[model samples]
Target: MVLTEYLSKEALEELVDSFSCAGAFELEILSPDGEVLARSPKVHSNKDSSINKEEDFIRFELPAEAEIFVGGEHVGTISLRGLWRTGQDSSSTSVGVKDSSNLALSAERQIAISPAAWVELMRDVVVRLCDLSKQVRSRVEELSAMDRMTNTFTEKKDLKEIYQLVAETMVKVTGTDACSIRVFNEERTELVIMAAYGLSAKYISKGPILLSESKIDREVVESRKCVYVADERTDERVLYKAQARREGLVSALCVPMIYRGQIEGVIHVYTRRPHQFDWFETSMIQGVASQAAWAIVNARLYHEALQAESIRRQLRLAGDVQRRMIPSQAPKIPGFEISTIYVPCFDLAGDFYDFIELPDGKIGICVADVVGKGVRASLLMSSTRSALRAHANYVRDLPALIKAVNFDLWRESEISDFVTLFYGVIDPTNKTLTYTNAGHEPALYIHEGKIRQLDVGGGVIGISEDAEFSQETITLSSNDVLIIFTDGLPEAINFEDEAFGRERVYAAALEAWGRGDSADGIGKHLLWEMRRFAGLQSRGDDLTLITIKLQ
Candidate 1:
């Protein structure tokens, strides 16, 4: 509770108006710093009073002072001054003299009668009015403090900021030297200082306060009640009595911060002189601590939610960048039709594919899958794609190009990272397909109702620095269909723990080929069959497929 809370400027002005009217004189309300808060009406001063300079006037102040109090806090003083016209008779036309003309005339007409008695009566009346104003202002200040505390708790949403605000506000309301808040450790074995105001850095750096050693703090935590010490130096319950004396802290009030039926911490208010905390002061501090607990809890929750949202946004951005690395549509080659599909189980995928057209009208195709999932795996996949593309341009031999890509991957990748890739060069004019499979799923070649599995290549990339690779060539006849896929299709499992194995894939591909479906249609049909087999089970890995049909 403070002065401004009880007696606002507007309310003080109204009081000044009432006092001036009753006393028939001017009044001014001055703060402790001599700043005028309210002033009564001055009739003659508002106009030109220089013309009447020679007129005799009696000016005097009230004998008694009227002290103002707001919730036990002395705010300012109210003074009264009177101006009486002594030269004129009782018929004087001067303002503010009409009401007190008889008293002035009595003092002037007789030397035996004194105006001291009349001044004493006026002082009594003003003192009574001032006492009444103090009572009213006290109530107003109490209510205002409570309202402000409630609003502060509702508005602030950061834990550290809320702690600082609560500590500072408590110090102001209680008129204490300093305030501090300390929260319990997670293990409930110690109290750690969280926020403080009006305290020196050296004082705050006092070593950790163990709960067992600090009696007052332990009492507040265990009993969930406030404890007060009027003399810190003499109280046996004070833990750091020597340090408190050194800091000139004479009194302390410790209040528990309870939230959801559990005591979380304690707020301590320190006074420079020995003083007993009254019921009003103690209750006000406890109220502040209660609101502070709620604010601290809510702020932490808000921060966690914000962090989760930020991570979600980053994942979305990474997924978009990874998708763009893959070809949007299959490249168009003369006498060949190609189609592809890629599905990632999560936001970011470990699988990627690309098609690069060489200078001799031949096209290079690549489909690779990293070992892991998520962001790390996606990063490795991107690096592998760049290395393969760079080496494929210069190294025309399938085995040599793959070996160069492997060396680059081994040099750049981590020990746990590896990629299984299948790359091929298609020469439509020669009707020959040259390819190397680096430990990937074997490519299926279907021609004239016969199926051939091509599995001729070295191990996966990024496993060894000097691993050798080999290539295989196959001649394509009329109406030949080639299917390249990752292991996701065969490894897809249902609720019954059954995998959609290679046999099922072969059967589906055979049926699609017999139906005379195009390359796109065949790839989609196989994917649909796999989904049907999984039946409500989530995808366990990334799925990718590339199909080429020679017309």
Candidate 2:
């Protein structure tokens, strides 16, 4: 049988090309029967060396490299000869056998060996070529499997289905009796079986595989490579010897599925009898492990995206509900202009503001900020809003009202959780304001060119049930403006990480008041100045502002 039948045209040509010396005649590898199998490129500058017929090229015996065998007979020794016009030296005779396929005696100089020595030399080259062929075929098989696995993952098959496919395919590829696909549980403390093939249900139900219990898996995970056990009976790493025996497992190979330097999972292959894995099986299984890791990562990302979408929907619903807690527009109190804006950095915000209509032409204005952010903080803000609203009309005194709200919040909130609140009742008929600030940003009161921070309340609400609160009463004056805001406004960061602090807040509000802007106009001007100072910087918290002017 010809070697070409066993090796592809490309493979045979590759064997010849490797032997093509620079500035030399192209080499032709021929079968033992003198049939041409492969020819290297015309490595020589001249194309004149192309042979017109197979007989025209002289062939030399390579002797058996013992590479190919059929039916107990050593077969197909490789041979090489130059692709040149058959010739003999007219001026000087060569010592080799006279064949019409030979070039002139000058070509014989390139060989520089006897017929026997040349055969020995060709034998060595043939051995190396066969070894290289085996390696190339192994890599090709591995790459083909990898491509199939990648496509399987890209198709977005169900993650469980992919796990089963990988388990079955790995067992088939490695010719193992059983294979199991396992991934770390959420806590990373246990390896849960995702898929198993060729294993009995009784054996698989052997209990949890903890990372702490198995030295074998720990080594695989820590080493980030394949671990092989020759005998399950004697191996100390085999934590389940009895189970392995029941399952008819002898030798096992375990490989870690690693992606981005993190080991995601493990794939185990077991043979019923002791069997050592070759390079081909080991490399192929490692490739399978890597592909498995990729599938795992993709599956996790997909699930996380689904979870994020669900949370977003719930947040929108919650935000809508909490937004209702904010008055649709600032309360239109007689003898006063009220303007308010609530800006949230995220979909859900911790900041909230409300205008409660109290008895007898009195309007209750409150702005509060929960201690944290996001859904948790937003929920707390909602709770605080309910508690404050519940007591706002019932408790007539400003200090008593704040104390009641604080006690309620303290009863319901965690030790670290609290709300900073500013609540006030403005009686326009009497031109009097009764207010309390509970560890909140002080209300900026501008009365006839005099600036005062209404900072009288108490420690923040929800920390202590017995927290004391103090009330401050002031008589309203014409053209006086009051600004109440959450800490986000003054603590707003700029690109340089500097804060647009209380000074800036005071300046902006003072400038707008000086310009004789209406309450709504002043709120807009303050927001514009805040945005200007915090140019292109991302806010980490929510901003809530309320502007009140005695018109």
Candidate 3:
């Protein structure tokens, strides 16, 4: 503490007054430069007399003076003087001598206390007051330091910045020579230094420290306690005693940084002198460590939440784009009704469908399912759809269109990814459907209460560039329905692990047809039946279905 902070002029005057009353004499408080800061009243009527000149008081000056101290540094002195009277009172009647041999003499003096005793007494009182002031100053300093440290922890947002601030604040508050913050790795096998203050880079980068190898760090972390080591040069618990000695560190304290009852790291403070850590200092450092831990945990959690939100936004965008890729409504075909349904288990789908109008009143209908899910599958599906559309504009043959699309997918997509597709063209003039099935579930044809499977085509797309395909034409009479879908329909599982198999699909189609359901009605009924079978189970894959019913 600074001397002037607690030893103001008014305080000095009060001290001098109290001392004068005790010593029964006037006293003056002088600075180290001999300037008077405070003075007590004198017994004699000499108030107007100046005490600035040391010459006037030299005759009555005390031989002893008491020194005022602040934190062991002397700032000023206190002194006392004797006041004397040298004549008789005017009220006394004096008799004169009769002759030259006779004479009358009178003298009066105010008794003063012994200078040595007064000096000792005043010195003790001043020393005690100074000591009390020092204690008060130290307490105020500590409280202010803690307030700053707590604010630092609360205001900082980044974990690394908080760590550095904590280390620096710890060093400042405790008057430590250096400080280091070591946080445990995710595996909890080692302690990694996150921040350091007032330490040499060479000493900080000494080497890796494994928790198993460092007993002191391990004890502090596992036991969630603070550990202190005095005389690091001789303490066996010191992990880097050689480095500590080189860094001129003789004392150390390690406090655990814990959050939610789990220790996350340790805050290590080092001092240059071999000093023991008191209870107050240890408790204060521990409190700082606790706040640091809370800040670190909050920072980590906030970062994770931000990352999760970013992923969610990306998924939503992908879902929107994938949905837009699929046709929003089916096209109009004379004497025919078309209905489509798509259900993706995730944000992006592997299943897609397109209805392209061809030349001469013919319409191209395609349903394809990629082998996988997510963004990759969606990309492959998009590329395949573009290829099919481009090829269908020129290529009239269903088998040739399938072959072109297969070649493009095989050349452009990853070798592991493949697509199963059913491409069919309906010739309204001839009332015939020509199609090719590329390793997909066969389209079911229901006519006159009889169900038939249209299973013709080749291997799945993207498996081989040289894959061959075939096309077949089937006559469609009135009341005939064609059902095309991905394997997700038949492979959908129930709570009992029972699949809604080919037989069930055929039965559902037959029942819907018998009930005189339209294309949309039949598709909706099939979905309802599938959901009923699945019961609380999630769809294992992307689901797509298209139904074409002849009017």
Candidate 4:
């Protein structure tokens, strides 16, 4: 039978060197397993060193410090003082031995020795190895459970699911029989319990804890680390602790969970026994808490991204609908030249322009800008245009037609939201232009190479429900042009932040008309001038330009 004491290689080397210098006897050192590890001589006396053979007569075993041994051509001394074991045992004479597998080492050796020392050494070695093995196994199992919990959270995409996962992991990893997770609300300066296990849900539902008041919980948050207490009964920090008493917590561990460098939450693990946790245990739990924090952040980001994409898609749809509402082609009025350009500041334009050739050979021209942008503005613009077109067939008088349009818009739209319009009818046979403006920008008229402006209109329509509108008339001659436009053109800014005001717009029109005798030539030149003036500057509003000439 053989007995052995397992020492780390470094400890063994020191002991072997000390014994060799003394030259007491030839020595054979074996592993925790019965296999000989090293020997004073280069080769074995009778047995092959490569294999553990039953035919070998000599077997070496670990001996206690100060112990002596001698044999035929083989002898040794061992020191157990520096050796590490699960625990200490003084009386035992038996030695512990490990097999080649390195899994288990046994001290129950059938060796010849004094009964008291033999029995004691065997008992101590066996018990220590067993306990150490169990501890290692438990640690591995705990780590495996932690991995499973983190994986479960990572598998989920929704933020709501993370609460349940974190709570379960905390309770399981701590072995505390109960656990809870909470978040801090900086705006309200309160802690909101998000999830809990092994506790009454009804009691915790009434949450929102003020950190400034909660001594234990707030301390954990402020410290930004794990807080632990071995015994709440004697701990000075745990005070006014009615909840801790009710929860039957004799020991507690509170760890702060951080996400993206922010203190997002805290996890509480409670135990009934007075427990002093080691650094390894606290660090392991903190690692798990960090995983929970990351999971929560990822879930929230995914949710927000989905919401933003949904909003963008809705805006795109609204833009498509608004575009379909506008006329695709301008009305063709014989003996009159008409051209228009409409540009929106946003994806969906509130500005709209249309030319309707009436059955009476008169052309109705409209350029309107709804007061806002997006779906609401587009809807209002669509409604206003529809109402005007329906009423245009009934009223030939420009003032009456505008008054009727205003009544319809004010009745249909909210008081705060309104439309600014410039509407008119062109009788080509008489070359007469009559227009009614609704608080819109002054219309420009370029005649005989001279620029004339008209701003004869009342307040904005649909603003004050009882707003009045008036009309003005002027005659256009052959080769004379009438320019109806939204404020987008005149109010456009340059890089210097200066507005391309009415003065500049009027000058551009005169210059444009003087450059070309035909209305088509003038329209092209005006647009070119505007584009150049507004270079690199975003269009501040919806721009609608309509030019009509009686030729």
Candidate 5:
């Protein structure tokens, strides 16, 4: 059988150089059938060419021969040629053959060694030396190569480059036909290839390797061990057997790359010919896989950190812009006092409030809560606030204006998006407040310590294109107070996760109003009461509130 597939030309050359004693020239590794599997191209030729022509060249001939075996099974033979100086005496000893004349110089032949004396001795030496250093010359060389690989791994910061380096090194060290690296996606549903070498891009793009479909990869991931497929074309465990056949990948060794006690990915080495990986090749790849796993983990962490920092910077800049959009101070209307508060748990908030000065001295007040958190919700809040302000003056009817705002929100939102809002106009001259609540936390109209929830309106905005809305108009009176807020106020959670329900909000509002406080005083007092009720626990959502009074 031809062992050409198993041989490494570089490793054989290195092995021959290590045993390059005096009178040794060429080394040939022949298969069981005497076909040359690998031969060192170091020093060789008959007396015909360069050796005789160049004075710097040494003379040599192929003569010594020995069998190479593993576990007492003869796999191949090593035939060595010996080096002889051109000026050596005729009686000087050779390695195995009788004619050093093939390498002889000046048309004279040097003596050869007795076949019986050194053939068996050189046979044991060549076989044992090759067996000991087939992969590497010594343990030190292995360690040196490993050290170099480790340094290379540590120096890498990009995941794709690291994977590519590891894949290329695997084929070089193991003498395999190809190598690929794949990592489990965040959901672990798919094995996505990060890098590959010695394989065509067409074969790699054959299909996604779904975990459920690839029994071999699933086994490697679940067991955290290497799996061998001697023949992928016929292996039932292989998900893409036909594709593997097209790729000419006959055998594969899948090694799990485990990081921090968890299997994160797999490293696969393939052979063009069917091959059972030996212990040395398996261990070498496993060692490289271990180092590569750590490098991959570090690269992922570094990339994620960069993304997080960029998001933080963006959110910080957005928060600054959002703060400018919100009314720094409530409009100061004649014969009326208004106050407002906005507290965001995160740098980016879903809640926003705006005051739009309308025609005929009617001031438009809006408090809206977009149905989400973070940057996305804040974006919706900005757009919704802008749309509502744009329609406030054009649509004098409260219900019609609410409908217009709802349509704008619906146009921009996905199915998961919507906004709860309270939009109202206060006419100081007419002493009337007209309002519409679009699925908002109802505004409380308080008179003489009684709380009336003004909650008449339609469903949430942005859910339906033709959502209907309703409105209410109330005649204002001296000492009458009105409060509007988002769900964050009443739904605030305590340390024990208990909500400060609507009743608590009413009680707090009444208690503050009973203090005979102005609108600003009452708003501040209500906020303090709610914070005290929450037991200083961090708020989970954006909190917003507004207080208005006719004094």
Candidate 6:
């Protein structure tokens, strides 16, 4: 049929200027919904320049296919089809064109399309539609799989489960022949394979591979970017291309897994045939890798915390053992009254005290503060106590005993481990109490209704690893009392960070010596004052006190 049809200015121009005389030509276009948007020719135009150019041309949008129109007449259909860049895109199909005469035939003369033409046209339409449908379906499937893979990673917490899911889901989404995930080691200096599918674990987990020179790993690791290879044979920079080709791998994608702004590992996929990797696929892989990275980090953190808890429990047990080693009560002296209080700041304390009576009517009292807290500190304190007690029996003089203990402590402990000590020997028979303060706080004496502090002692033990110590003595009369303690007592502070200074210690001593001179009451009163001053809050360090009263 020779009908005048409206056409776009450009199409009409092209047909008139470029195409041959046409007795009849069909034109078709699609609507927004992909249906055939048909229109007939309005009138014949011999290059009429007066007609509205805007109104003469018709355009339709089709999700599957579209056809251009001129003056409302059908034209050739145009379609956009897509396939994965894989070499498998080629296919064969039978095509048939519509029989236009059948539509205009009278009931009888409109003989059914010759069986051959009918089949041809039907087959053509069906095949085209099927191809379009398949392309759409493939894209939808990929998107669905990407979403599902991300969901699975978020729901799963176990590393093994996550790895398996990642491998399977990624392979399905990308249609890859194999997949693997490699994680960075603790120091984050190298990448170690953590999981794989369709790949040997031995190859993956052999050892951590350094990033500096690793051809394949370095690309993704250094870039913190995704890498893709469409045809290994054509890409000279690809690592293990020979192995990949031998294994039928023609395409690959590597997505780096990042955690907390660092590249933790990479997710790799391999296709058995040459394929195209586009922005969409790269985005999908990165989305999945991001979730996987967070999951791996969370799993590792949980595992590490469990290990630390186990270690902490063991330390608590060790602290209990150390506590058992300390004597619970003070030893009785022949003619002296003694009271001692021991407090530990943590599960185990670095501070310790020991009381030993000599054969010549004398009592030795020792209070020491180890430099640190916890198991190491407690162990060092234990060693110091044992060595000091052994040497106490050999040295009758307090100064010599302290010097020996300092030497032993310095020798037995590590460079960082040291002790500050206040050691004293009370001679009730001669009314004299001698003491040595090895970097320790001065002792307070309440005698003749007066208060005095003895501040003479040697430097901290273990500083030089071999140091000597000296002693200071105070002659006590009847009704005199002496207070020997670690710095924990005088340095004790309240929540305000105020220390109970020497003035307070002196005042407490005077009050006790005046009020019946009760050593036990004085020690208890001092602790009570400290507790009240601190408002029953946490004590930052150990609190210890040793008191001796002369009758």
Best by TM-score: 2
Model 3: CA > 4 A from native? 1-155, 182-194, 200-250, 261-266, 356-362, 386-420, 434-442, 452-473, 487-508, 529-542
What are the RMSD figures for all models against the true structure?
12.1, 8.7, 9.8, 10.2, 11.6, 12.4
> Whose lDDT is greatest here?
3
Span of ten consecutive residues with least summed lDDT in model 4? 97-106
lDDT (tens digit, per residue) of candidate 6 on 302-330: 77898889988988898788878767887
TM-score (all chains, Cα) for each model: 0.62, 0.77, 0.65, 0.68, 0.72, 0.69
For candidate 6, the 10 contiguous residues with the lowest summed lDDT are 81-90
Q: RMSD, model 6, all Cα superposed?
A: 12.4
Relative to the true structure, candidate 4 reaches a TM of 0.68
The candidate with the higher TM-score, 1 or 5, is 5
User: How high is the lDDT of residue 347 in model 6?
Assistant: 83
Model 3 lDDT per residue over 145-202, tens place: 8887777666767888888888888888777888999988999998899999999999
Ranking by lDDT: 3, 1, 5, 2, 4, 6
The deviation in Å at residue 262 for candidate 1 is 10
Error of 6 at 71 (Å): 40
Q: Per-residue lDDT for 1-551 in model 5, tens only?
A: 23333346665555555444323344566778887665555544445353433332442344667776654777777776545345534553443354543444333433354332344454566556556554455445655777788898888888788889988887876678899999989998999999999999998898999999889999998888899999999999998889899999999999999888988889989999979888877888888899888888988899899999998999999999888998888888888899899998788899998899887788888899999898889889988988887887788988888888888888878889999999888888998888989899999999877889988888899999999998999888898999999998889889888998988888878888888889888888878877898987988888898999888
Model 5: ten consecutive residues of lowest lDDT? 51-60
lDDT per residue (tens digit) for residues 1-551 in model 1: 33344457887777667654444445676776667888766653323343124343344433223555543556666655544343345444443423433444323233222334433444355445556666556546765876797787788887888888988888876678899899989998988999999887777887788999999999888888999898888899988788888888898999999999988888989999988888877887888788888888778778889998998799899999889988999998888889999998888999888998888989999989899999899899988989988987888998899998899989988888899999999988998999999999998999898889988999999999988899998999877899999999999999999999999999999999999999998999999999999999988899999989987
Model 1 spans with C-alpha error above 4 angstroms: 1-150, 158-160, 170-177, 181-194, 205-245, 249-293, 307-311, 447-452, 495-498
Residue-level lDDT tens digits of model 4 in 346-458: 87788998777788988788888889887789888988998889989988876677778788888888877898888887877887888878888878887787877777778
